[model samples]
Target: MSTTTPAKVTVITHPLVQHKLTLMRKKESSTNSFRRLLGELSTLMAYEITRDMPLQDLEIETPMEKMTGKVIDGKKQVLVSILRAGNGFLDGMLNVIPGARIGHIGLYRDPETLQPVEYYFKMPSEMQERDIIVVDPMLATGNSAVAAVERLKQLQPRSIKFVCLLAAPEGVATMQKMHPDVPIFTAAIDRELNDHGYIMPGLGDAGDRIFGTK
Candidate 1:
């Protein structure tokens, strides 16, 4: 976690996540190692993000007696991944809430403008009845994340939370300015964004690292 976090932004400081993030950040880490670390780190982050999920009491019969248990309705959860890099979080989160629905919003940042351009959008039905967790590996310029959240809002989902492996101060400010209602969760909030809108000292192009395109 960084020394400062903006209002409504949560930096997950779990040791395991921090350790894996360190490994992922190393330029020497292989694509296989980076991908695997991201998966393991995402699972840990997901656990923290869903901490406040409301639980309902359920009655069940045990071999010896009847008892009441609390459980969340996984079906009411929706994870929206922002394009290629965001897909890396899918498997780890699914491991936690297997019944949760999945969605994808394909958005890429224009090289010149650093603005988000949408190529595809798909979501589960009855969005109004579900809570959405938007996933993207890096919140650098925040353009793509902002665009994705803007689009998802059209469906009027119950709520929305943004999650990333790393975030820059500029990006967090941008998101907080535009979508103050949506909380942000990340492993770390780095120093700043570089000239080209990349997070300073970030784990390098997450999409490239995850897919080994670079």
Candidate 2:
């Protein structure tokens, strides 16, 4: 359930991300606020996720003269939502990368052993040549994230990254070990996980709050 190994676990903790995550954590917050907060946090995560994306120069004609314009290089970035909660993050990621291709990897965790088993998976047209960024709101047990990434690996994506609203230490460690190649970007890493695999002092179910299905 943990890894003492040093891994690339990034804590966003940006003011905007923090402020929204706080509001989403409150018991009184409404569904609208929860959805808004998730979008805000997801935007911040998207920024970090694409920080080092390769870029190329393109010829462009300006009002004055022809010049070079920046284009997303062959990085071929694609957004893949992990389903349900992952859609929350996808909403914001799309805002930033308008033309980016989209993908979906749906997995539901088994309540008994807390393992992620894929029920459905549909990725972008060409995943092997692209770098996939998988989105999910909560990383409590890390089972879902790891399993999703494991499935993604079979697609032969050049690289992968994980984006989440919040995470527990146990989950972060587990994911890092399971997929050392995939860097994690999250709004916060909470203290611990509770008995039922929920983040400690963490916001209740993100899916319920965002969709108001509770």
Candidate 3:
């Protein structure tokens, strides 16, 4: 196991992200309210995560003038959602980068072993030329995040960034061990995970709350 510290974890401290996360954490927050807050929060987080995207100068004509302006370079970016809950982040991110290609990785954690089990996965082609962003709402045990990244690494994307609404220290450590090169972006890093592997002080089961399945 790698002993390197997780230096790539980015905790989003934007006031809006922090405020919206607070609302989502409330146990009494309604499903609609929670989902709405999550969408808004995801948009904010997306902005932060894409801060370093490459830009290129392009000559364009404006209403009355032609000027060189900067535009995102290269092909449309890719957003891979670790399915079910990861879908919650899609709308907000797509709203920002409407042309981004969408990918899905379906996996569930086995209760007995607390390990991720993959069920489905599909990604856009030409991954080597495009950066990929993997979105999931929670990184509790990091099993799913690690598994998803491991699978994506096989495709050899130009880059990979992991985004989550919440994360735990244990999860961050696990990800650092497995894929330290992949940075982690999240709104908050909550307290430790409980025995059942739920992040304490987290917004409960994210998939359950997002879909009101609980």
Listed per model in order, the count of residue pairs whose N, CA or C atoms clash below 3 Å is 0, 0, 0
Backbone clashes counted, model 2: 0
lDDT of 2 by residue, 111-135 (tens): 8888887888887777778988888
Ranking by lDDT: 1, 3, 2
lDDT of 1 at 126: 98
lDDT of 3 by residue, 96-185 (tens): 777799999999999988999999999988888889999999999999999999999888888889999999999999988889888999
Model 1, poorest ten-residue lDDT window? 1-10
Q: Each candidate's root-mean-square deviation in Å?
A: 3.5, 3.0, 2.2
- Give every collision pair in model 3: none
Top lDDT prediction, candidate number: 1
For candidate 3, give the lDDT. Answer: 0.91
lDDT of candidate 2 at residue 210, scale 0 to 100: 79
lDDT per residue (tens digit) for residues 84-201 in model 1: 9999999998888889999999998899999999999999999999999999999998889989989998999989999999999989999988888889999999999888998988
TM-score of each: 0.96, 0.93, 0.95
lDDT (CA) per prediction: 0.92, 0.83, 0.91
Q: C-alpha displacement of 117 in model 1, angstroms?
A: 0.6
